[model samples]
Target: MAKEQTAEKGITSRAEDFAAWYNDVVLKAELADYSPVRGCMVIRPRGYRIWELMQRALDDLFKETGHENAYFPLFIPQSFLAREAEHVEGFSPQLAVVTHGGGKELEEPLVVRPTSETIIYAMLSKWIQSYRDLPVLLNQWANVVRWEMRTRLFLRTTEFLWQEGHTAHATAEEAEAEARTILGVYRRFMEEWMAMPVLTGQKTDAEKFAGAVRTYSCEALMQDNRALQAGTSHFLGQNFARAFGVQFQTAQGDMDYVWSTSWGVSTRLIGGLVMTHGDDVGLVCPPRLAPLQVVVVPIWKSDTDSGSVLEAARRVEDALRAGGIRVNVDDRESMTPGAKYYYWELRGVPVRLEVGPRDVAQGQVVLARRTGGKVPVPVASVLESVKAALEEIQAELLRAARERREANSLRHVNRDQLTEYMEAGGGFAYGGFCGSPECEVEIKERTKATIRVLPDPEFRSDPPPASCAWCGKKAVTEAVWARAY
Candidate 1:
């Protein structure tokens, strides 16, 4: 049957062709697919479930940090986006405009938001009246639209799901602190849950968000050695407040523009996860982020003994589920045990338990980890073993990713050496930048490398480079430069 071959067909090898491998894995794994709409994608149930887990985890963090969830209009008045000059110019080219409404020409065209900073600030102005309302923390989980000429499934789609956090504060210091705080949260989430190591630092002026006074990000290196900006937190200072008339009366009877910040992480994170830990076999999800932490596939010598094995598998599943594990029992009669193993492995289930007639008789089950290890545990200890294996797998994934990042990363001292190395194949290259836009532009033009992040001393693993890598000028700071996604 055609269904049987779905698991038989293998994905493209990541080493031979990484991009093709990514697309093949995404389609073969049923995570996502192209849509009729240009540059858009349909997130299948498999993919959407991963996103749901991401949403729940992030929402908990946002709430614990005093941010409340809210909704805003999907359509923004064209004039509203034009309120901030830099913001408007930055997003204008990507804006999808709507002119007709209700079978009639609208009086004013609307822009499907590229980002919600402009429109959200418009509402904030009315909500905050005095210093008592200075810090207004809000977050929204929503889909946003941006017209794109080129697109990839979860990486660069025209329409994508994301959570945008917007906050308003009374002073520059408070706003800056809020941005950094969220940046730290993003770093923690990416490292702990996703098990992807990241370099947290500031973006160069050329790389910062439009109209932001400063932008900080957690830049992660993919398995292919390219950089992915997994998350960003931007400090808007007084720009959005001034443009949108968001001001609160001070306790001293004076009115001043509110300081603002905005930060977001999108489905692009799904892409990062795929690239960061995936291999030639398929996706290898960390236990913490995996939708199905454990899958029990019952094996049997014959259909005569299948019921017994299935029963054992069910008992194992029930025990894991009771212990707070997301477990699935593969009891399909149509598939072989090998097919089931291939199916769950391709889908990146973290731990797989195989309960066969012999194992059931012996009161043991074979434990196979997605991270490439196997063991046998007594049936009585299945729950405890699964718990321990999941924890061990989670830690190992983070450690392995960190080791790979360090291995692929390179250190360079000058432009020539960096360009030569990048021309061959690009990775994270630590070096010094002169902090000149010209120098940055030249490197991008020649080697296609951008400053991924300017690392803080504590985050930098090596001694600082003495001079600019792109220009032989005095170095402003040590930077991790790479060709990015």
Candidate 2:
């Protein structure tokens, strides 16, 4: 019995197999389930609730930054995409076209949205006829379809939900500023709310968003030491506006194409959350983003004990909820207190309150943390105790993740050392790039590690390398390289 329990605790331990452990946490925790459709999964209620919290927080940030919510069509005319040559070419392989609708063939095929840039700009062109109409900041909460050859639940799917912000400005400088503003928003949300640290920087041209003059990204290092692209901000630089005829009369009375920007973070962030904090047992959700931050379990052996324990449990739940916490009370008669502990811990509830006959009689309840701490607290002070524990847990998760990333990261790495590190299971490496596509391609073909970014000024190394790490050519910039999802 002891050995069996130990096996359960160690099943698919991340040290032995990270991929299996991730799937175990996601499926067994009831976050999501396999779906009937290929390359897609059904996000269960618990999973969706977490996403809802994320949406509410991110939506709040968008609104604070002068963005208004709007709706756009999910289907686009095939000709609309063709207006932008690079956009059409980049997404052609993943395009899902519908030739027949309402049981008849349509005159022209309609393409499900892989992204909204083209369609959104097509509309923006008609709306923005003057400088006053410029700087249109709009966002949409919607589902997008991109026929990915491979999918991993919330990470990548045939269909996924996200908020895409599209903005148009009268000048390139204004549009660029908007893109950077969004980049900061994504970074702040991930680090402050999700308790995940990220490196922000400009993506290499080879990896930048299709049709974007430049793309900025937030790169998070997961527990497995691989990088995840958590979010992106793109500067369109009049590409879409020109292609869609979105021109505005300048304040000086001249007509010119509007500069544009698009930025988004999607359900893939859920996957990033799972990878950043989950442990061998299961998920380790941060308190701020957890769907249920606290769970109260009442222990009773008889009908007499049940009444008192239940009453105390409800009291604790109400107190915590009133204290501005997302909480729930679990009072299932069929399950044991031990079983309830395991279930809630696996689901990553940040804190658990155990109300038993003795604890209730003493006017106290046991406080348990998902990160593995337990103490008895008087009912009078349970709310304060829980709030402190939750705050500590949220901070600790971020600290531990950042420490792990730094420990594995190697700065000023040479080509050989980087290749060896990647083959031995990689982490981030600071190196130099020659700014040549051939150089980037050669390194990827050799090491399977791409440059995650030319890190922003804050993250850039002091006294940057004088030569490229691979070919020893004159270095144009310092880059962060890692094997990524």
**Per-residue lDDT over 1-485 for candidate 2, one digit per residue giving the tens place of the 0 to 100 score:** 12222264444678877777788789888899989989878999989988999999999999999999999999999998898888899999998999999999999999999999989998998899999987899999999999999888788989999999999998899999999999999999999889999999999999999899999999999988889999999999999998999998998999999999999999999999999999877888999999999999999979999998998899889888899999999988888989888888889898988899999889999988888879999999988999999999999999988899889888887889888998988999998888999989988998989999999999887778788989889999999999999
Q: Evaluate model 2: give its TM-score.
A: 0.97
Query: Which residue pairs does candidate 1 place in steric collision?
Result: none
Q: Tens-digit lDDT track for model 1 on 1-485? A: 12212124787787777888888778877889989988999998888888888898899999989999999999999999888888888889999999999999989999998889988999998999999987999999999999888998899999999999999999999999999999888988999899999999999988899989999999999988889999999999999999989989999999999998999999999999888888767888888888889999888888778889888899898899999999989888889889888888888899999988889989999999998888889999899999999999999999999999888788854778788767867778888888889988989999998899998667674667778887778888888888998
Worst 10 residues of 1 by lDDT: 1-10
In angstroms, how far off is 167's CA in candidate 2?
Answer: 0.4
Q: Can you give the TM-score per candidate against the true fold?
A: 0.97, 0.97
Off-target runs (Cα >4 Å) in candidate 2 are 1-11
**Which residue pairs collide in model 2, if any?**
none
